[model samples]
Target: MRILQTDPDDARFAAWCGVWAASQRADRPDELPRPAREHVALGRRLVEPGGSMAGTHRAAVAGDAVVGALRLLLPVRDNTAVAYVDLAVHPDARRRGVGSALLEEAGRIAAAAGRTAMVAEVDEPVPDPPGRAFARHHGWTCDLQESRRDLALPVDEDRLSALETEARAAGEDYEVLTWRDRTPDALAEDRALLGRRMSTDAPSGDVPVEEEHWDVARIREDEAAHLARGRTVLTGGAVRDGRLVAYSELHVPLEEPERAHQGATLVLREHRGHRLGARVKVAVLRELAATLPQVRRISTYNAESNRPMVAVNEALGFRRSGGLSTWSRRI
Candidate 1:
């Protein structure tokens, strides 16, 4: 098999992107199938500095046809010693050496870039999915477990009202604020601080990563990238003493009107236990309901170990659909 660099705008890249969606549909029959346009947007190259890029792509071709794909996410600002991998072999090409060949090339690329480890997320459904087994058989350690939870939208108003009412009493000292797309100039710095904390504060089992470096400039760059990628971001933040203490973000792709994603919800450690997480998420849900009523489902992934946040999501009516195991191996 010949592995070649594929341009995002080219047909091969489109075919390569299809491999991921196709694999998911075949393996996770219970999950909703992603629209092809959404998959293409996901695979679009966002080559800004640091961890902003969707990832670099390599298409594995054999018999003059593409049968596998590889995405290597390199972190420049931090975690310079590792490469994040997203690989998929066409269902028809499985067991034909396509997966192995693509992974071999991935290691070479990571090593050439001076990275010492490769990390990947594999499906780990009940009874041990083939993908997770393959990772273990190839010497990758399952480092973390994240379950995908989905909430069917149009949240019951009475339930949301009660959640908000309870949260208000708990977070009475804080104020909730909402915005769309970009961070307000006054809260830009606050947003950056939370964004940086997200890297370290979130539960990251054995995954090797570091606190992400963030600043107002980087925040603007990220917002710009989102606009360029056709993604609409809705954010809700909690303010205490005129500074943000907690925040939640909702990401909706313009093309996929029916699908939405819950990006991150964080409360400063010192600010925890006040239901700020729930309060901010409730604010976001309200904004989503009012402005983007077309969104029918919101998907989120959380480490199984994060009980507090999981409790909040459960209270908000999210149910588990599937899970992913983070697999890592030293090169």
Candidate 2:
């Protein structure tokens, strides 16, 4: 077997995408099978090297067939010590050393880039998933465990209204504002601040990550990347004393509006307990229902130890769907 760097534009990338899509479907029963073309779209949109995050895609090939694929992400600005990886091995080709070969290559790439640790996540429907066991066999430790939750959409209008009313009672002093695509210039700085806070304030549970660096430029860069990937970013923020103190965001794929991925939802340390978290989330969902009623589900993951946020999600009718765990090892 030989391993090669595969550019998204390379014809060989379709082979990698096939492996990725098949592996995802086989391992993650909760997720529907997305066409390899969607995977291609994701690969082609890798952020440029030297940006906040740089990435590379690698494929493991035996003769004419690809058996495994890996995407390595190196954060350039912060969390510089770790390389985040997403790896997949075709079910038909597992246990034949393809995964081990790709893993070694990934480590070499991370080391060459001066990284000291590696992190990867998996969808674990059960506690002892094969993926977790494989990580353990390789001396990696599961550092963060999160509960994956899903809220079926077309939420009952009455229940949503009641949630909004209750949240408003606690957040009466704050202003909730939302925007699509681009954040307004007046709130860019505050949004960036909140983004940085999300890195630190969120329950990390020993995950070897540091506060991510964020600024207006980084925010704009991310937005541009989202647009490049054909995604619509919906953001809602809570403003207090003319500055954003809390926020929530969602990314909806323009081509597939049936589901949306929830991003960060944060309330500044000083701004906690006001239900601003719920208020902002509710606002975003309200806008989603009004504008994108085709969206049938919203999915989010939260550190299992974060009961407060978990409670907020439950209150909004999100139910546990599966599990998400991050495993890491010193490179």
Candidate 3:
């Protein structure tokens, strides 16, 4: 098998890569299947510098056909020493040395770049047949566990009203804002204010990421496009003091009916301790219920250690859905 450093600019092959991912998704149980257009858009974003682009993606090709591929994404800057391995092996061609070849190439790329490690997220009940053996054979170690939760919507109106009332009593200083055609100027400033919190607060395991490596412009484009595609709703609540203290997103899957996923709900450091976060979250859920009542479930995941956020989610009625394992190994 020969490995090729594929060009991100090759439109025809890029389109093929998008199709390959969607086809692979067909076998995964939890994720909703994606349309070709959405996959293309996602692929474009992942390779774009300000977007989710990591190092390089290589394809394992035999003769004229592309059989397997590997995707490496740079999720954190300080962890520039590391890369997230988003793996894909065409269903028809698994076990033919495709996966092994791809992983070997990945290690070479990481080492050359001066990165110290590489990681991937795998589902649990691990020692179960396929993936467990594959990971072990590759020298990948499973280290962390994450819990997933799902919230049924149309949040009891009484519950929402009561929470809103309690929140207002705590401090009637922040208002939740969405990004419309004309997003408030304050929104941009709020992102800046909350930027530090994002770089430091999220559950990145042992990776130090500085704010500079984060592509703010890419974030804006992706968020805007995601909104346009009707995939996500982003809400930021800014304090009257001009600070964006808390933010959350309710992701509405485009292809699936009545299913939405939640992204990171961040509350700035200084803004903690007050019941503001709990209020902000419930308020967003309530608004989602009122506006997108068709949504059946909303889901989120938290590091098993994030007690504060988990407590808030539990209060908002999100229940455990599943768990994912974050495995890391030094090169």
On lDDT, the leading prediction is 2
Q: Rank the candidates by lDDT, best first.
A: 2, 1, 3
Off by over 4 Å in 1: 29-55, 124-127
TM-score of 1: 0.93
Ranking by TM-score: 2, 1, 3
Cα RMSD (angstroms) for every candidate in the order listed: 2.1, 1.6, 3.7
In candidate 3, stretches whose alpha carbon ends up further than 4 angstroms from where it belongs are 1-31, 46-55, 61-67, 75-78, 124-133, 180-183, 207-219, 224-230, 255-257
Q: Candidate 3: minimum summed lDDT over ten consecutive residues — where?
A: 206-215
lDDT of 3 by residue, 170-241 (tens): 766666555422235646556655654676687766433345333355456646667545475645354656
lDDT of each residue in 1-331, candidate 2, tens digit only = 9999997789898888888788878877666655565566566556565478777899999989999999998888899899998888999999888888889999999999999999999777766777887788789988999999999998888888898999899878999989999999999999999999999999888789999999999999888878877789999999988998999999998877898999999999998989998899999999998888889999999987898899889989999988999889998
Residue pairs with clashing backbones, model 3:
78-208
**Native-to-model Cα distance after best TM-score fit, residue 304 in candidate 3, in Å:** 1.7
Q: What tens-digit string does per-residue lDDT give for candidate 1 at 1-331?
A: 7999885677787677677777777887766555555545555534643445435789999877788888888877678888999888878889877888888889998999899999998865564787886787788998898998899999999989999999999878899999999899999998899999999998999897778888998888778766766789999999999999899999988877688989989999989999999999999999999999999999899998899999999999999978878889999
Give the winner by TM-score: 1 or 2: 2
TM-score of each: 0.93, 0.95, 0.80
lDDT of 3 at 312: 78
Query: Please, what is the whole-model Cα lDDT of each candidate in the order they appear?
Result: 0.85, 0.88, 0.66
Evaluation by TM-score, superior candidate among 1 and 3: 1
Model 2 CA deviation exceeding 4 Å by range = 34-50
